[model samples]
Target: MRLAELSERSGVSTATIKYYLRERLLPPGRRITATQSEYDEEHLRRLRLVRALIQVGRIPVGTAREVLAAVEDDSRDQLSRLGTAVEALPHGPEPDESDPSTAVGRRTATALMRQAGWRFSLGIADEFPAFRMLVGAIAALHRLGYACDLPHLLPYAQQAAQLAVADLDLVEEFTTPAEQVEAAVALTVLYEPVLLSLRRLAEAEESNRRFGGGS
Candidate 1:
């Protein structure tokens, strides 16, 4: 299809598509003439991915570009591609390692992972802000007089690991490398809120069952 059809199908404006073309976010369509080009399903898919990254995931264009580049780079293996996509996500500001709280949080995170026997790549925890957030949550709970020791947290870690395996299995279902990359990116960015909402609902149901008055 032409640019107009691509824009219509994607719900993206032709002007924005032109911008993406210039930014190299969307690959050039087939050149039919000096000024005319035609796009295909691949372009449509890429446009949708770019839109989701920017509009829904709230990823910066630069970061989205890096992710797109990683997705398209056929030289890298699947794991490397997924790692690159993850690394392109925005993270919180680096903690001051010298701070006592930061030091304690890091130590707690390390201990929890060790006790849980969670196998991870070297330095992966250090690079992931989500891990740091987990550390901070544990520290905060401890400060509030709640025990967040390894034994207390092991169940959650085990459940999360199982979920991660399931997520990877879903990614493996896509036949093409591009489809797998798209699936990985979409699931990573989109399913987080769904998971959190489900957890919240489950907690509410459990609380109501245990504490609510008969009605």
Candidate 2:
């Protein structure tokens, strides 16, 4: 495809596409002439990945470049490539420093992960941004004077572990490392709402079952 076609197909402006090429965020296409280049489907795939990293993920250009490099690094194994890609994504923001629960939550988060047997899932405690998000959530409950400790959270952890396994199973259905990694990233961001909504629905059903309040 030509630059204009690539731009239209990718829903990105030609100007922005030129900028991405100059930024080396997207690899240049094959040279057909001094001023013309021919792009293929791989360029299309990469353009979307670059856009997702920048626009949806809100990662910096530098980080996105590093992530793309990692994704394209054939020397690395599939798991390593995917791990690097995922770790590059932003988890939610850190809990407020002023909140005492931030400290308490960090401790609780560590203990909970250890009890759940996932402390080493990323080869270190407090490594993934999701771990930080967990800390913030636990901290919030603690701030509310609730027992948001390991015992209280273990069942949820067990269920989440199962979901994690299922997520990996789905990612593996893709034939390539890049495709699998893209699926992993997409599922990570997109499925949280699905999971959360289902939880709420389940709670409603269980509540109605126990209380006889529904038709």
CA lDDT, every prediction?
0.83, 0.82
In the range 1-215, model 1's lDDT, one tens digit per residue, is: 99999999999999999999999999999999999999999999999889888888898888889989888988999888877876676655565555566667678778878877765732588766677777677766766668777778888888988988988899899899878988888778877888899999998888888899523
Q: How many clashing pairs per prediction, in order?
A: 0, 0
Model 2 residue runs over 4 Å out of place are: 54-63, 95-100, 200-212
| Tens digit of per-residue lDDT, candidate 2, span 29-129 | 99999999999988998888787777766778888787777777788888788877777766778888798889999888887777876746535656676
TM-score per prediction, in order, is: 0.87, 0.80
| Model 2 C-alpha lDDT versus the unseen true structure | 0.82
Question: What TM-score, to 2 decimals, does candidate 1 have?
Answer: 0.87
